[model samples]
Target chain A: MRLRLTPRDTSFFDLLADSASHLVVGANLLSELLGADRAGRKAIAKKLADVEHAADEATHSIMRRLNSTFVTPFDRDDISGLASALDDCMDFMEEAGDLIVLYKLDELPARVSDQIQVLQRCAELTADAMPHLRSMGDLTDYWVEVNSLENQADKIHRKLLAQMFDEIADPIQLMKLKEVVETLELAADAFETVANMVETIALKES
Target chain B: MRLRLTPRDTSFFDLLADSASHLVVGANLLSELLGADRAGRKAIAKKLADVEHAADEATHSIMRRLNSTFVTPFDRDDISGLASALDDCMDFMEEAGDLIVLYKLDELPARVSDQIQVLQRCAELTADAMPHLRSMGDLTDYWVEVNSLENQADKIHRKLLAQMFDEIADPIQLMKLKEVVETLELAADAFETVANMVETIALKES
Candidate 1:
């Protein structure tokens, strides 16, 4: 039997869910930046930055709450892990967009867009799953789906790498694209890490 | 003023300290691989892998102990953070070395060696600081110095990126070198993260 305590503030899950929503916005901005005209690139990146800042604020709230609240909704470690992973996903999205702006790449490869699509799905899935934590409901599907998306992203990433080396002839451009792709890959990896954390918590709770 | 309980296992610190020491060995092998001739590259990478496997074993031991022990030497979060960061450092080092062998580069630029040297210093400093974690004695300098080293690495990293764009001609070669340099940069970043974790623990304990 498990001892249950009513959380003074259920707002923790709300904040985390809000952060995940921010990631969706950031992911969309990134995907849009890839296909958008050159003139609109900076605007997209700035919007992505705004989303990242909001996520940062949300993460700080979680941390502050974790420190102040004697009785949390779940383990402090799990809360912190989820918050940090969400923040990292946002950070990597912002980074990939920033690299595009910084490098002034006229166009990103099509597969890059595919990876961003995976990120958007992961973000949405995470947001949907956050509220369920209050009940410690079944999250196996959430994590399993996220992991599947990550594997798709990884496949796209590998193909992109091979294409970059096999076909791209200019060293400077290859270097620039490499950074963007790698950042995207890191975001995908961070999302999977978040899923893994959720799975760990679910196993411990259920 | 604070209540303390004697931990069932003091060996957790010993395991973590051992992992940090393994990082030093891994860093050295990485550095040696850069300077060594092609004939010896495989040997160096294999040695680095051995060190990584040893670090992995130590990290697993720490995790097992955390699961079993009720009263840990410090917060389980801090212990896990330190161990994960240490493991990440080793992963990045091995990655950088493997990229070298996979790329089959005849020679690496001098600044990469400079970055590896910084890694060596960071590894040594982390190994030195892990034991002091038991006492929660003055760790201000450890983190501060590690942060300083990271700054130096960032400088070297930026210079290398600029130099790569300015000097390197082959796109495929540039991609390979960039991966190695970025991995090394990540290793430095991981070290800073470990330092930051140490500082967090010290503040909480003190």
Candidate 2:
């Protein structure tokens, strides 16, 4: 047990967790969008957009708290960085969903589903890990796992790129699919960034 | 004149300037590549890669100095953030150049040059602004100009996208050209990020 003279504001943990929880919902919505027809995807995408807006509000709350608070649980920039990175996870997922509807892409490469699964797992792990910032314990596994998941996501992305160029005959279709795939890859990278920030915080605290 | 008890390490300014100078070389190389023949484009891209590699080393030096030195000129994360952002600008420029070569894109849309021109200006402005960081003086113009330039780049990017999709009939050609254009747009965004970081630092220091 540890003791402190000044009580640190701990609500950042809840805000961060709240922000990450959106990623899980966003990723699952993306997965659902993949299975739905055009009309269904449009509906699912709208829901995803609403969730993204909510996530943005959550991130703003974290930022407002960070600016007003004098004694932070961790470094100020790290708190902001963590919040922004979490927001990015939601943004990219939301973008991927939107592009699918905007481009009216009827078919996506099969591996795109693999990409979403990785994001879902990352979101779950990140949401689970935010509370641990208080203890700074049992975090090594979370970061390590997210790092490995990102690597897997990278492999899938490259392979999907190769597969798309090799098989997709219509150039316009190829363009739309490529953009959507790349956006999903960006989402995976964002999750990795969040995990790395958590690793930095945990290491500093340890 | 500002008086301080501890003398801050001033070399970070020079190191950052050195990193940013590579962007000037890189954006020039990219511009030159756009005008070159296929073989010439390949050679110019190789040169740009070397410049990018050198820029990477410059960024690493900043990171190493930041880690070993106790006192930085600004917030430690801000320093790292600026360094990473500068590196990203170079990376995106290099990728745009490389894709031009790899895809063998013979005739890019005319607006593509406008995108590179924006980058060239941004790079020059960024290299110029890094030294001002030491003084934290005369920086408002730098960020303001870069932000405006980014807005210009965004408009150019959207026009280029519409122009390409409208005029280019072959989907494959459009894919190659679009990737190059998007990468340049990203480079411009990265420069804006560096400018934003500078703005944050100057405000904090003030």
Candidate 3:
């Protein structure tokens, strides 16, 4: 490891970690929403919205700190990029949940749970990985695993699309489910984007 | 304008301008596809796919140059970011065209054409703005107009969605048209992202 002559502000890492933690909460709420009744889904989506708001605040704080500080732990743009990417993950997840509620969709396909499960795994992995940014150690596995998970999510998404097209006769219902599924896929993609950003940062720092 | 002592490599501007020019072609092809019948759409979509491939090549060229060159006219990351954003515009437009063919959508909403018109305008504005990067003159109008165009696209998108839900009784047809419309909107948003990145670069430069 290279040594630093001057101390860098470390709160950025904490703020990032905080931002990612909200994703975990949001993802879990999405999972819960999948299992809930309509009323239950509404409550869970509300909670997810609250978590999304908190995540937004976390991102804004990071941005505020980034602008105020001359020296950063890494490139200013990367910090903002990572932060924006994390916020995207939450926004997609929250949007998925809201669509589930708004469409009043009853009986989503079984594979949708599979989609949420992938998101949960991604969120957990991402949240676990954020604190490691300081040392930039043990991050290869984190990004590699997230990349692999995203592949799994993609396969699930394609299969789910095919299944929906095959089984659902109702187009409106299909539209609603497809939107939710696509939004979830976007969330998974966002997670991969974060992983990719982290990989870029790690390579640059190394 | 700030004066620089060191000579900067200028080919980046040319490559970027070339990239944006492809967007004009792609967007126009999209407009043609909307007007075409099934056979014509397939032919046009094939052509659009070719354009998308060409755009991809342009983007890759930018990346290759970025990697090989030491001195760039602007921040290396900003150049890459702008290139990627431009590529996204083509991807979404190409996807919209492909879906139009794949789903065999016959009668699209009038507002769908409105969406493409907005994309056409954004593409023209973006293509026009890219050459100005060398001088960094008259770019504020470009980004500002693109931003306003994106807002118009969003409004059209929401109205189209509501209209499709209210008017289309065939669920499958609704699904196909809605996907196409949303993808076009994504193309519009990608243009805005490019504009936003340009704005950021211009600010930093100024």
Any runs in candidate 2 off by more than 4 Å, and if so which? A1-5, A9-72, A75-81, A94-107, A110-132, A135-166, A192-206, B1-5, B39-57, B60-68, B137-166, B203-206
| Pairs that clash in candidate 2 | none
TM-score of chain A of 1: 0.95
Q: Deviation in angstroms for A52 in model 1?
A: 3.8
Candidate 3 vs. true structure, TM-score: 0.70
Candidate 3 deviant stretches above 4 angstroms: A1-5, A14-71, A75-81, A94-106, A110-132, A135-167, A192-206, B1-6, B39-70, B109-111, B137-172, B196-206
lDDT for predicted candidate 1 compared with the true structure: 0.86
- Candidate 3 colliding pairs: none
Error of 3 at B156 (Å): 6.5
- Worst 10-residue lDDT window for candidate 3 chain B reads B63-72
Residue-wise C-alpha lDDT for candidate 1, range A36-142, written one tens digit per residue: 88789989888888888788789777866765676767776678778888888998889788778767789778898899999999989988898888787868889
Across A13-40, the per-residue lDDT of candidate 3 in tens digits comes to 9999999999999999999999999989
TM-score on B-chain, cand. 2: 0.97
lDDT of 1 by residue, B97-157 (tens): 9889888987888999999999999999999999998898768789779978986897798
Between prediction 1 and prediction 2, which has the larger TM-score?
Answer: 2
Candidate 3 on B1-206: residue-level lDDT in tens? 98887779899999999999999999999999999898999899999989998998898788667756767898877887898899889989998888787776888889989999999999999999999999999999999999999999999999999999999987777777877888899999999999999999999999
TM-score of 1: 0.68
Taking chain A by itself, what TM-score does each prediction score?
A: 0.95, 0.96, 0.97
Using lDDT as the measure, name the better of candidate 1 and candidate 3: 3
